[model samples]
Target: MTILYMLLSSLEITDISEQELELIEPLESKFPIDKIKVTVCCQSSFICFRFYVLSSRYKWMTYKEAATARTAIGCGLIHHGILKGSCIALYFINRPEWLIVDHACAVYSLISVPLYDTLGPDAVKYIINHADLKAVFCMPLTLNSLLSILSEIPSLRLIVVVGGMENEVPLLPSSTSVQVVTYSQLLSQGRSNLHPFCQPKPDDVATVCYTSGTTGTPKGVVLTHGNLIANASGFTISVKFNLSDVYISNLPLAHIFERFDHISLAHFGVAVGFYQGDTMKLIDDFADKETPSKGVFCKSNFKHVCRAEYI
Candidate 1:
């Protein structure tokens, strides 16, 4: 009778294999998205791989592609001597390239400092100087704004502009040692010279987010990879997410709230669509009188998911 009782207590309630357990373990790690499913929409710009989600408007990037880009970009940064713990600034609006740069920063253990799109030159100058940024990624328009203060930021040695060729970049001052290149060029260079990913400790700082500077001088909020994972994991407890969810990111990714929002979506293999930097334009694109969609429910679902806890 005692043996029978012991056997009953020892019996496993759930039958999960080691392989399944291994897949689930990443959920607790600082990089949960590394293990999640990879899915891309039919209109994806890249070749079809196993995709976990789909997009209606722009091409969707699968987790696999993101991982590849992360490694490739990390390699490029290494060639430029932007080693781990170096500060890299992202000065673009919410776009696919932003995600690629963010993940690449994580892959190489580089600290990402995001600049607000609406921020004036003075704010940009302060944050870049304060963080001692070594490199910067910006859109062509944002690059124009940075040009005015590029000479002031002595630590900045590299400027990679998105959506523009090198010849198109505005001439820089002779005194500034900054070398300008395009985003694709960097990716191509990196893919040609691949490198191993950096393994960051749980306490390693991931990003330095600055406040809006409404009250005083904008202060930098340093966040560790574990802190971000904790924030994303907390949201997972309240509302469950799956691969089917599509997130429309209208908020500035510079904000900690929006940064965690993307991390949470990545955890669930959810697709994200960036608003075209304009709210009214987004409304027209979604509700265009001529274009038909899968339905309004998909769009409404995005709102529901985004409205969840931000912290």
Candidate 2:
């Protein structure tokens, strides 16, 4: 029983390996110096990782590709162009910057509906029915409260759950009337089928963002890719951000505020320090004690304190 329990508990990945753990166990009379390892507590947990700029694997990309493809697509939702269709409805718990860009460029020309994460099921149902959303591109939802509302959202034709397969959400319904896809699948279709130069243009209507009116029904706001590019670029040039800055992230990506900064950072090749929850919390914990070695706070919590060379 003890062995089984130990094995089960051992699955948690510490950023440090057995080799580093050994060095850590013996209290060295010496101070924590070059490559010193320690744990830091962060927004909802503890995380661990050695401090270094070039050690991580995730790479920063450039701007030229930003206009060609969806700014960011997950593992399953990859198909583009004709497959994406037009006059679609995008339901996001977060801001849909990429969708708007596509809409602006005449790529997807989607109508976006924003769902409030804190609302009860009843409110969600009301918005879906009222919006006449034809297709929804969204991150996976917990408790399937989203799926329950689907039956009531008549205009909904497709559901796109972004990212990979190991997600906790349940398998989408077996019904053929409404289909579910992952983000990568959409990108795959585009990569394999679309003409390399045939991507959405810069001047088209990128997306329709519906405002959540507290007193009345929601109103849709038309936005273009040009708008997002201009907005994101303003931050990029003014913020002095560079390709090497790393930011620790955890904010819902479905808002324009996040998109504004994401475009700036992505264009510059900023290394994003994504936490696997607690495992990545250590980096921030360490950042708190020392001078910020280019600290990036929660998605919304961040702001430009200095331009590119702030660190």
Off by over 4 Å in 1: 1-59, 170-175, 288-311
Model 2 CA deviation exceeding 4 Å by range:
1-116, 119-123, 126-132, 163-176, 183-203, 211-217, 249-251, 274-311
- Looking at model 1, the pairs that clash are 38-51, 38-52, 39-51, 39-52, 40-51
What is the per-residue lDDT of model 1 for residues 103-217, given as tens digits with 9 covering 90 to 100? 7887567898988777778888899899999999987878877787876888988889877777897667677798788888888888787665565665888899998777767
| Alpha-carbon RMSD to native, per candidate | 10.5, 17.1
> What are the Cα lDDT values of the candidates?
0.63, 0.40
Give residue 108's error in model 1 in angstroms: 0.7
Backbone clash pairs in model 2 (N, Cα, C under 3 Å; residues 3+ apart or in different chains), count: 33
Candidate 1 to truth, TM = 0.75
